[model samples]
Target chain A: MLENKDLLGIKNLSPFEILSIIHTAEKMKLRINNKKLRENTLENYNMVTLFYENSTRTKMSFTMAGKYTGARVTDLGVATSSVNKGESLVDTGVTLDQMGFDIMVIRHSMTGTANLLARNVNASVINAGDGINEHPTQALLDLFTIYEKKKNFKDLKVAIIGDIAHSRVARSNIFGLKKLGAEVVVCGPATLIDKNIECLGAKVTTDLKEALKDADVVMGLRIQLERQKGGLFPDLREYSQIFGVNKDLMKYAKEDAILLHPGPVNRGVELSTDIIDGEQSLINEQVKNGVAVRMAIIDLLIERRKKDEVTNTKWSASESFIQDRWEKRYTG
Target chain B: MAAAKGGFTTICCMPNTNPVVDNEILVEYIKMKAEREAVVNVLPIGSITKGQKGEELSNIGLMAQAGICAISEDGKSVENAGLLKKAMKYASMFNLPVFSHCEDMSLVGGGVMNAGEMAQRIGMKGISADSEEVIVARDIILARSTGVKLHICHISTEGSVQLIREAKLRGEKVTAEVCPHHFSLTDEAVEGYDANTKMNPPLRAKKDVESIKKALKDNIIEIIATDHAPHHIDEKNCEYDKAAFGIVGLETALALGITHLVEEDIISPLELIEKMSTNPAKLLGIDKGSLEVGKVADITIVDPNEEYLIDANSFVSKSKNTPFNGHKVKGKVKYTIVAGKIVVDNGELMD
Candidate 1:
C-alpha cells in the first residue's frame, strides 16, 4: 500500500512500494495473457493524458491502461489544445480538474512539471515523462522485467551504459536498484557521466567493458546527437566503438545476463541492433510489461486517492504501516 | 516599504522593471516616488541600452543628471560589444558605474539552473559556469579599455571570481557582488524543482558556492546585494523551466550573511557589514550604510542571536517567492532606522 497519490520518481518510492507495484503488475500481466478483462476498479473515473511533449509509446500505454480499467480516457493534443494558446501547466491542470477529471497523466519536456501540476489539481497526477527528470512508470516496468528474471535484488549487479547525464531512465533505475539492495554500475564517458553519481550508491566507470563483467543485467541508453556537439563525447562512430554493446562485449557478463533498453533503440549507437533483437534482449519484454506496470500504477493511485478521501488524511493506516517498514529497511 | 522593513536604508534598483528604467523621465519618476512613498532611499539604475534591448545607449547622461547613480542592463547583457563599449565610455564621463548582469545569451540558451550534476539529475537545461565567465571576461576586457567603474552583479561561479580577481590584481577598476543565495545554496537546492530556487545566474554547484564564499572573504567580491526581484504567485508557481528567474532576497540577505559567513567563521562580523553595507554605500557614492557621528543616522540594529524559521507569508514584500522560506536562520533585524526615524521597530514596521 503506497501512500503517494503521484508516482513522480523511483527516488521517492520505498522498496516495499516498488515490490508492491511489481507484484500488482505481475498479476495484471498474467490476467492479460490469459485473455481476461481487467477488473473494472476505475469505472466512472476520468483520466486525461496532457502531453506537452510528443510521445507515442507512453501516451498509448497509459490510455490503454485507463481504458482497460473501464475508465474514460481523453488525450489532450498539445498542438491543438488551449495549452497552445499560452496556458500554463497549472492552469491547464486546474481547468481539467474543474471539468471533473479524476486523474491527469502528463508528459512535459520541462523537468518537475508533474509535481508542479500535482500541487494545483484535486486529481491524481501521474508523470509519464518529464524533461530528463524521472519517468516513474518506465522505471517500474523495467524493474518488473528485471525482477521477473532475477527473482530478487540481493547480490544482483545492474550495469547502465551510455548518456548517464541526460538519461532519466538511468537516474531512476540507479536510484531504484540501489534501494533494493542491488549494485548498480553506471558506465559512460567522463563527460556523459554525471559528477558524484556514485554518491547515489552506484559505481560509475568510464570503461563499459570492465563494468559489464559479471553483471546480471545490462541497460543501454540512447545518446542524443545534440549532446555530441556539446562535446560530451565524439561523433557517432567513436561512441559506438567505445561504449556500444556488441557480441564481443557480451562475453564479459554472466551466462544468463539480460540486456534492457528503454527505446526506440538507437541502432549501432548505444547497442548493435543484433543484440537488441537477440535472445538476451529483454527490450520487447520491457515494452510488454509497460502496459501492466502502468495499469498497476493507475490502479494503486486511484485506490490510494479514494482511501485518503474517506480517511481524510494524506495516507491511510495500512499504507503508513508498510511505508514505515520500508523506510526503516532502506535507511538502517 | 519592503526595503526598509527588510532593514535596508538604501537600495540600488535594477533597470529591468515593468517599464524598464531607461530614460530620464523614468529615473525622475522613480526618484519622485521613493521620496514620496518609500521608507528608504531608492537609487534608480538607468539601463545601459535604451529599453535594455542592447541596441543604442539609453539617456545615460540625462538620467545621471537627474540623480541616477548607476547605468545597467541588469537582467539582459549588452550583447553588442561596440554599443556597450560606447555606453561604458559615456557612463565613465558622468562617473556612473556600470553594473553588468554578465551573461552570454548564446551560452545560456534556455538554461534554467546551474550546469552540474543536479541539473543532470533533474533533466533541466544547465547554464554553465562558462556562461557567466565568458561575459565576465568580455566585460573586464571592455572595462580595461573603457576605464568605467564596472560592477558585476550576482557573481556565482568560481571562474567568474577568478576573472574578477585577476582583473582587480591588474587594477582594471572592476568590482563584483555575490548574492547570499549564491554563496549559501548550490544547484542541489534545485533537486526538488522549487521555482523559488530559480534565479538569474541560477544557484551554482558546490565548488562554485565554496568559491563565492572564499571570494567574499578575500574581498574579491566587494558587496552582497540581493538583486531582490519580486514576482507574483503565477509567475513562480509553475514548472522549473517556465517559472520566472528570480527570488526575493532583501528580507533574507542580512540573516544569510550572518548565518553562512559569520557563524561559519568564513568572515568576521564587521566584514559582513562591510560587504553588506559599508562597501555598497561607498561604491554607489551614497551618504548611507554608516552611522558616523554627523551622518544621517541610518542604522539597522540586528539581534544577531535570534533564530527563527523564515516564512515567506511573513514577507513584507507583496510576493512570497523565496527558497529560504522554511530555512532556520539566525540574526533578525530588531529595528531599522533611517534619517533618525525608526521605520522598522521590534521586527515590525512602524505605521
Candidate 2:
C-alpha cells in the first residue's frame, strides 16, 4: 500500500515507496503491451486535472490514464475557468474537493502550489509540475525507463546535463535516482548550476565530458532561452558549443549509455539532432512509460483511500455498538 | 485584546490592516477605536503609499498630524527607490521613522522558504538571503542620502545583520528589529510543509538565527517587534505556499525571549526588556517603557520562573496560527500597568 496521501516530491519518498511505484508500473506496462490496459478498476470516481500552467504531453497522459482506468475525468481549462477570474488556487481545489472529486492532478508555475493544494483538499493530489520545485511523475517515468534498460540502479552512473538550476525535472531525478543508489552527476554552465545542488547528494561539474564518462543513463534538460536576458547565461551559441551532446563527446561514455531528455528538446542547443533519434535514445520510451506509471500511482492511491474508509467505518461502528450496550445496561 | 492579554501596556499597530491605515482619517479612526475599546495604549502607524500600492505617496504629513507614530509599507517592500527616498524625506520632516520591509522582489522570485540546503532537499523554490540583503543595502543608502530615521523590520538573515552593523559603523541613521521566530527557528522547521511555518522573509538558516541572536546581543538589531500579523482560519489552515505569511506573535514574543534568549545566556532579562520595550518605545518617541516619576507608567511584571507549553487555542487573538504551538516555554506575564492603572492584574484583566 502507498503510505502517502499525495505525491508532492521525490525527496520525501523512501526507497521502498519508489520501488512500489516502479514495480506496479512494470505490471501496468505489460497490460498496455497486450491491449489489456483499459479496465474498470476505478469506476464511479471523479478525477480533475487542474493545469494552471500550459502542458500538452503530461496533461494528455494523465487524462488517458484516468480514462483507461474507468474514472470520470474533468480537465479544468485554466484560461476559461474561475482561475482566470481571480479565484485562488486553494479555493479552486477546495471547490473541486466539495464536488466529490476523488483525485486532483495539478500543474502550477509556483514551487509550492502542489504542497498548498494537498493541504487544503481532502482528495489525493498528484503533482504534474510545480515551478522549479518538483515534477515527481516525470521522474518516476524516467526511473521506470532506466530500470527497464539497466535492470538495477545500484552503482549506476547517471549524467544530467544542461540547465540544472531551473529544471524541476533535474531536481526530482537527482533525488529519486540517488535514493535508489544511483550516482548522479549534474553538468551545466556555472551560472545554470545551483550553488546547493551538491548538497542534494549529487556531484556538480562544469565539464560535460567528465560527467558522461562511464555513465549508464544520460538526461538533458531544456534550456530556457528567456533566462538569457536575466543573466542566467551568456548566449545559446556559447552554451551549445560547450554543453551540447554530440557523437564526438558521446565517446567518453561506456558504449551503452542511454540518452533521455524531457522534451520539447532544443534540438541543436542541448543535444545533437542525430543523438535524439539515435539507437541509444530512450526519450520516446520515457513518454510511453509515463502513462503506465501514472495509472499505477492513481490505482495505488485510490486503493489506499478505500481501505482507510473501511477501517474508519469499522472502528466507528464498534464504538457506537459499545456505547449502546453501556446505555442499555444503565437503563435496565 | 492580544496586546493586553500579553501584558503589553501599549502597542504600535502596523498599517497593513483591511482598510489599510494610509490616510489621516483611517489613522484617526484607529486611535479613536483603540481609545474606546482597548485596555492598552494603541499608536496607529500610517502607510507610506496610498493603499500600500507602491505607486503613489500617502498623506504622510496629515497622518502625522492625526497622531500616527510612524509610516510603513510593511507587507511589501517599496520597489521604487526614488519614491522611498521621497517618503523618507517627508517622514523625516515630521520626525516620524520609516519602517521598511526590506526585500528585492525580483531576487525573491517565486521562493517560499530560505534558499539553502533545506530548500534543495525539499525541492521548494528557495528565496535567497541575497533578496533581503540587496534591499537592506539599498534602503540604508536611501536613508543616508535623505538623512531620515529608518528602521528595518524583521531582520532574518545574517547578511542583513552584517549590513546593519556596517551601516551603523558608517554613522547611518538606521535601526533594525528582529522577530522571535528569526532568532529561534531555522528553515528546517518548514520541512513538514506546515502553514504555521509560513511567513514573509520565511524562517532562515541556522547560521542566520545565530547571527540574529548575536546581533541582538551586540546591539546591532536594536529592537524586538512581533510583526504580529493575524489571519482567519481559512487563510492559514492550508498548504505552506497557499497559507498567508505571518504568525500571531503578540502573545508569544516575551515567552520566546525568556525561554530562548535569557535561559540560553544570549541576553540578560533587562537587555531583553530593553529590546522588547525600552528600545522600541524610544524609537517611537513614546513616554513609556520605564518607571520614572514624571513619565506615564507602562510596566509588565512577569514570573520568569514559570514554565508552560505555548497553547495557541488559549491566545486572546482570534488566529491560532503559530509554529510555536505546543512548544515548552518559560516566563508568564502576571500584571500589566498602563498610566498607573493595573489593566492586567495576576494574569486577569481588572477592567
TM-score of each: 0.87, 0.89
Docking class for candidate 1: acceptable
The superposed Cα distance between candidate 2 and the true structure at residue A271, in angstroms, equals: 2.3
Local accuracy of candidate 2 as per-residue lDDT tens digits, A40-76:
7798888999998888899999998887778899999
Off by over 4 Å in 2: A36-48, A67-103, A117-123, A229-231, A234-238, A302-332, B17-25, B49-59, B79-93, B142-147, B170-173
Candidates' C-alpha lDDT: 0.86, 0.87
Q: Return the top candidate by lDDT.
A: 2
RMSD of each: 5.4, 5.4
Poorest 10 consecutive residues by lDDT, candidate 1 chain A:
A321-330
**Interface RMSD for candidate 1 relative to the native interface:** 9.2
> DockQ for each candidate?
0.35, 0.34
